[model samples]
Target: MNNYEKVLVALRRVIRATDLHSKRLSKNAGLTGPQLLIMRTIRDLGEVTIGTIADKVSLSQATVTTILDRLEHRNLVYRVRSTQDKRKVHAHLTEDGADILARAPEPLQEEFIGKFQSLHEWEQSMIIASLQRVANMMDADDIDASPVLDVGAVLREDGWKETKKKAGA
Candidate 1:
């Protein structure tokens, strides 16, 4: 296979692994991957704004708002308008939300964190560096306050170019 095709195959494996893990996490914890991630962020940051949550979760503002809507409708969180700023809405966990957060599952697909924690510090660092290097080779950028750089972003940019060539981004 060509280099690009080989890379595509490897990416498919990564994506499939993530999907499988998300499904398992959902089945075991009753929370989707993204929901669990948001819960953990809320637990860590206490009261936080939607924009902060979006940045923390590596999602677009609009996407985070939609997730927050679902979370709010499920009574997992509450939105409070800032008394000082009025226009600022901060999301706070409810009692139920807190309980849920306390029991929330791990964010990583596998018990990678647990396993990594068990490794020697140097070993862990090496593995992380290797993975990060691979990610960099794939052109994945840092998530927060940086450019988007997942397969989705690559696809979007390339798709736009292809479409423009065909018709007109």
Candidate 2:
């Protein structure tokens, strides 16, 4: 196959694997990858502001706030209007949040991160450069991507409902 086709196939594999893992995480633990990530961040950072969580996860504050809304609806977390600074909001994990976190799967990036970190510095740099080059070639440099590994676009798309229903069944 041509290099472009090969790269597409590889990217497809990576995307599918990520989606499957996210599905497993949700089915088994009732938490999306991003939800689990926010929970873990709150746990690690200890009652931090929404901006802090956004910064920690490399997600925009609005995206973080939206997810926090979902999480709050599910009673996994609560937001407190900071007394010291009324404009600042802090996120705190509920008991249920802590328990879910205890049972949650590893972050989707954990394995990839471990292996990536094990590579030589030069190899790591080469991979980063190559991936960025591919992204540029695909005209994806302007996309608002985050480190959250749940395949958010696919998950939110029209077909995702049918796909998720079938997967859940």
Candidate 3:
């Protein structure tokens, strides 16, 4: 195969791996990558606000708020206005949220990061440069994306239904 074909295959493999992990996360924890991430951040931060969660997770506050809405609807999280500062609402995980989060599989990037960190510094730099070049080549450098690696919408509850519909499935 040509070098370009090989590159495409590698990219496809990466995407497929993310997709598979996403499915497993949904199946095992009933949470999307972003949802899982937001919950984890809330648990870790304890007294987090929507803005705090958004900043911690590298997502927009609006996106975080939407995800929180869904999570709140499911009884996995709750929000309360602080008496001292009613304008700033704090997010907290419910007992059910903590229970599910405790059992949720680690995000795919956790494993990737562990392995990436084990690489030599120079090798890491090279990999980063190459990936950046690829992004530039694909004209995706300007895209607004958080650190979440899951495929599809960050917190779409329906999973792949939209993709399937688009594909005429």
Candidate 4:
């Protein structure tokens, strides 16, 4: 195969791997990949509006609303109208939702995170940088790029921070 075709094939493989992992996660956790992602987003950003969730998850607002509808119907989540802004609705996890979220299995793709962590620091940086370059070549927008890739920083317990210490504040 030509160089371009080979690259396309590799990209397709990565996409397929992601899809397969999501399906496995759904079967094991009783939550689809997107649902679990949304729950985690809600946990991180409490009482978030639908638009905010959509933005955080890189999904369209309508898609998030549909997922929220299912979550609400399952009694895993509930929406409350903002008292000061009647037109705004914020989504919060119900007790049942929290319970489910607590028990939900990690995504199969997360295995990659563990493996990535096992690699040498330089190896990890190289892999991430290569992926970021590939993403840029594919015409992914600047906003869609991961901060971790852009800044060469890891999401530590304290949050996203540069790996290298700056000379001064």
Tens digits of lDDT, candidate 4, 94-138: 999899889887754366778889999999999879877887897
Q: State every prediction's TM-score relative to the real structure.
A: 0.61, 0.86, 0.90, 0.60
lDDT digits (tens) for residues 1-169 of candidate 1: 9987986898788777666666666677666666677777787899899899879876666656766777788898889999999888999888887887677656663366567688999998997797678778865443222222222322232333443444422
Off by over 4 Å in 1: 1-9, 109-169
What residue pairs clash in candidate 3, if any at all?
none
Report lDDT per candidate. 0.67, 0.83, 0.88, 0.69
Q: Compared with the true structure, what per-residue lDDT tens digits does model 3 show for residues 10-123?
A: 999999999999999999999999999999999999988999998988877877888899999999999999989989999999999999999999999889999999999999
Question: What is the full ranking by lDDT, best candidate first?
Answer: 3, 2, 4, 1
In order of listing, the candidates' clash counts read 0, 0, 0, 0
**Which segments of model 3 are wrong by more than 4 Å?**
155-169
Can you list the residue pairs that collide in candidate 1? none
Q: Give a tens-digit lDDT track for model 2, residues 1-169.
A: 9988999999999989998998899888898787788889999998799999989987667667878898899999999998999999999999998999998889889899999999999999999999999889987675556777777732352334444455563
Which whole-number lDDT from 0 to 100 does residue 107 have in model 1?
A: 64
